[model samples]
Target: MSDAEKTVPESADAAAPESAPERQAPRTLTVRVHRCGPGGANARFDDFRLPVRPEDSVLDVLDRIRVETDPTLVYRHSCHHSSCGTCAMRINGRERLACITRMLALGTDVVTLEPLRALPLLGDLMVDMRPMFAHIGDDWGYVRPVEKASTGVPHGVARYTRLENCIECGACMSACPVSSGTDDMPPPEARRGGHEAPAQAAPGADVADAPQERMFMGPAPLAALNRELARHPEQREALLHIGKGPQGEKHCRRHLACSRACPSGVYPAKDIMDIRMMHGGGKD
Candidate 1:
């Protein structure tokens, strides 16, 4: 072979520039779930360690755990999106839609999961939403008329309509102070002189003589009632009657927790307050 015609292979170090970048290591996370069997049996916390990406949501973690680590892990999810609201649960002690809550964004190495409160526990990370629906009577319609001019409706259509804001996820009911109990409730005296006490207190009633056991229909139902009234003004008399009842808007302490917990921007607390105003409950 002539010196000029000699064949040579490229060295590994010389070819390193053309090589693909090294793959980054996946992040490790600990998922802590509040588990319970049917009828609330074997209640305990189950921690699952898994490698996950930053974009993975809490629902994704749960799916991986159930598929790979534990097939017996029970939970509810549908649509894999926030529209269904079926995957709503308490994430890190706050009400959230698991399908949309990114685990890494929570800024915690360990993610805590629990079923919503004030509803019957169906199992791990699942609650019975029937009670909330029962309060929100079936008479109310879910769709409401929207202005056709802005919606660009077809010429044949009479009007455009849209779904009501409430997704009925029961997050409001879970966060409601009234629905949960009065154990953590602040005294009437402590609650006075703030936005918390919107309704007027009776004369000479500075402190609660006794912890009044008020029966509340809850924030979700009252918000639904407000929507019902807006859709059908003819039903005002009947709906207002319901709002003024013992288990209606009158019982709400105006904690406003429901407004903060709602993922769909329903602002249930404001709805309850509006009903109270319609009932002649003066503004604070």
Candidate 2:
């Protein structure tokens, strides 16, 4: 008990599970995922054993493996919840929100995760969304605006709240057949050219007819079209003009897969219907 003689308690590690070491060992979960390297070659399934818990989602497993075991195991994820659409990936052959897709719901102990197909894959489980967002802009649609009268009271304010819940997970685009194969399409970039780039119509060049490319409108714009149309009780005809041309409302195939896979339930198919009704009629 003397001040100088008193000793601090031994560290927990010094008196640990020497008698039952196996009980402290972490449990391993089987992870089978598709992988692609720098070039498109060497595509194959890569397996890894990860320490995981029953309540963990597929995203959680991928994150744990990437951080604790292997840094090269690449994937996109943000918000951890469904708020940010960064973590959308395929689980067990279906498009789903990896952050919410529970490990137990993944069926077999051997879980499989993959990137959204048809889009450009940056690495394992990461695809370029530039193409997807570009299609959204090309559709020339905007979120339908509520009138001033509707904003006066609480009842009107909440009218469009449900549609705003979309996280843009891109599961819709992954399910679309057109986005997978069309090569002439331009991926969505925020702007056409850099600030310093010369204007094509300044002098000798006839930039008016600069070969407007025929691009396939992807799901984000189609989803936006749906969101806008859902509230556009009056502007249906005008809004239909947004997606009217070759790459507009004419592209949707009425698959309804977009709505089925939307993690937040934005109905791109129904939106396409509204556009069709405004323009003329549905395709036969």
Candidate 3:
């Protein structure tokens, strides 16, 4: 062969750089989204397989399912970055906020998304949080006009200032046995059926209209109560009023799941203990 042809063989290594190994496309994940139409109609688990990026969150997958896969898949979320806990749901049986929960971190090929337990499932992953805060009256939910707001944490005092850390994500409420929806969880043998709302509207009672008095006061409200109790020690009698009620602290079995379910570390279970102690209902 000619010199040019011979040079071609030698030039190959110098002329061409090795191509990078082709980046594999993100693997598809099976998103098992529980679906319940408006008013809890046609409830069921609709599984959709979609390519998931490593950084994609559970909320991201749900959004994708809504936009790209199923338009009717209903769910609720707010401040999709974790500031608002509106996106809290059951992921792989644990209560968590969908926005911050990374899909890959789930460690399973199929990620199950269920509504937070212990609440009325409005639709799909959406549960009525209204009842969670029902016990905390408007005045109780907020710090009333203070002669002086806390300047800062007093020296050497472990004040319960992390109250603000509670985004009221409802995870604690979902985990609580007394949260009203815990009993509705389908047995493992039963498997997926459709939408299982914990407290189905009674014959004459509307789920929305059900009396808060009859509802089990969830940890969310108790956490709010803790804030009020911390600020106003004189309201001990008012706190006792709730403690003795049928749906009040008396209903809690001390499951302690509330603290585990809390994404922000609010640990409403501990707050419950404190409230009970002050009311003379809990032990020392």
Please report the candidate that would top TM-score against the real structure: 1
TM-score for all models, in order of appearance? 0.78, 0.67, 0.71
Decreasing TM-score order of the candidates: 1, 3, 2
lDDT of 1 by residue, 102-142 (tens): 88899998889998876777799888887677777787899
Q: List, residue by residue over 138-256, the lDDT tens digit for candidate 2.
A: 54434444434543456546434222566777887776554444223343343222212111222223222222344446666766765665565475555555555455655555556
The number of residue pairs in model 3 that clash at the backbone is 1
| lDDT for each candidate structure | 0.77, 0.65, 0.71
C-alpha RMSD for every candidate: 11.0, 12.6, 12.2
Candidate 2 accuracy as TM-score: 0.67
Candidate 3: 10-residue stretch with minimal lDDT: 189-198
- Which ranges of candidate 3 are over 4 A from the true structure? 1-25, 141-163, 181-215, 280-284
